[model samples]
Target: MYIRDKKTSFALVADKAELDYFHQVSVKDCASATVYSAYCKMTNDCPAWLQAAFWLRDKMSALANVENIKGFHNKKPDSPPKAGEKLDFFDVVEISEYELILMSSDRHLSVLIAINMQSNEGTSKNLTITASVKNKNFFGHLYMVPVRPAHSFIVNNMLKKVSFK
Candidate 1:
């Protein structure tokens, strides 16, 4: 997947080798591509580049609090090997990770490991992002800016104005 010069984005589907490394970091992060897409769609605008940025900034700054991951991975064996200890959650599961290429009219911020998957040694396309964001807020904010290319800086400015509000 690749992003064009237009107001659009690409789905970075990694391969098996890349996925292994991505899964390592992804196991900890809470951000999901689906959720991000929905948040961007809320803007009802074009490419959700800016929407993604805002979400990333907020997520990176906020402390990660993930639940059910341990349970999802695999339960430890008890002293007596309790009964009904199976790995069902891991059977049907999904992982979300991506490197958003924020290409604005001027500045282009690449290598943004908001969702891990830092290593780029392999050459496969296993991961994919199905971007279909509708709107961000249920009730849209009048002055709310649409997700654009050059808005990460603006989002940072606003965030700095009110830290963790």
Candidate 2:
């Protein structure tokens, strides 16, 4: 279903209980691209600024003993990723023609990200990205302090850059 007007809903996600945080952003009139393609382009090809942010995050998170995740890089795949496969830091939970769901869990928290594509009147489509987080401990809650606002900025920037050929 389309995530219109930034409505908060976890209808597409299975594990929705006890979510500590949730956010959604929708982009209108997106260029012609499959749901998988759009998600890959938006995430895999990390911009310089975003990569710098991730680098800082990795270094800081290390103090808490969190595993250093392989930050996003320009590694676009040729085909759709399969369920149970790794898509950067997330695990591909589910994927279809119109939607994709990814999850990542650690000792501190579990994060779920959903990408949905809804066809519009013409060639354009509406693309929405939703993120839900469940904090597993005190560190998880603290980790989100900076990440929460940063998430909004990062998603907005990434969505604006998404343009399919």
Candidate 3:
């Protein structure tokens, strides 16, 4: 549960005493993409398989009365989202030139997703995604049983689709 080599604002959430689950993934060599643009690519242009996975996830979550997250959109926004705006299912927590932090909370759990961009000597950029969860009840713990592994797989696929320029 610790992320090394990368300094991330995610540490704030990771340090929380109630942290129940945590995962981080990164993609390198994205020289031309900004934090907002990279996020748009990962979400707006989601592949068919990942879209289907979202569908399945929504259906399963509904059975347990968990909040249903909106599926990825095909239309990309012309501008970056602001703090008070909504980005898919998450509320925009903070958005800046090099970082975007989003969150969603419900009766079961609160989830925070942070996307951080690091410039490597001005030649290339690295994108790191960190997901932190805080389970509020038994259902939250149970929900993550399947979600933990699936989250890593899904994020890897999404990261691969992020267009550099």
Candidate 4:
């Protein structure tokens, strides 16, 4: 598959090859994708502290009228999804047999979580969760200064959570 310019972002950890690699492999033997690809891995299942941080963020961002980054539509789900079904929780863009594309956007940036899969055999498979962020303005570029470094660290740890089943 080909990467579109619209999918490009200033993500610190995720790259085009990474996202494409996941998309290429994610369809086989996989029914659905994970949430917060990297963030939840860092915080250990979306802890209370993270929730508090988000609360603060929402309030603060509203003050500046800047939009907060919205990640996965759902943190946990009782079941998998069906194509064309709007996610009950997350700000989803689209869902298909092979991939789950979650999205969020604002004046500063647009983020997409492309949850992909690949299979090695009838029983073996892998999940490639990639986050892509694109800067929308000068402030976005400036804001990424610190965010990029943090993202690199968080994403590295997140990879450890991957399991080949």
Candidate 3 minimal-lDDT segment of 10 residues: 1-10
- Model 2 ranges with Cα > 4 A deviation: 1-17, 163-165
lDDT of 1 by residue, 58-105 (tens): 454244231121211122222211122232211211223333322111
Using alpha carbons, what is the TM-score of model 4?
A: 0.56
lDDT score of model 2?
Answer: 0.77
lDDT accuracy of residue 43 in candidate 1: 27
* Candidate 1 off by > 4 Å: 1-118, 122-133, 136-143, 146-151, 154-165
1-165 per-residue lDDT for model 4 (tens digits): 224434532222234544311212122233324433322332345445445545665665676587654332335444545544445323555454445666655676665666654555665555555666666777656555655555554454445555422
lDDT scores of the candidates, listed in order = 0.26, 0.77, 0.78, 0.48
Candidate 3 Cα outliers beyond 4 Å, as residue runs: 1-8, 11-17, 163-165
Q: For candidate 4, what is the lDDT?
A: 0.48
Encode model 2's per-residue lDDT on 44-144: one tens digit a residue. Answer: 66878878888888998999999877577577678888999988887888889888888888899888888888888877788888888878899999999
Error of 1 at 48 (Å): 26
TM-score of 1: 0.18
Residue-by-residue lDDT tens digits, candidate 3, 1-165: 222224444533446455798888888876436888888777776778777877888988999987677587777668888997988888888899888888888888888888888888757888889888888899889889988988998888778766354
Model 4 residue 132 lDDT? Answer: 67
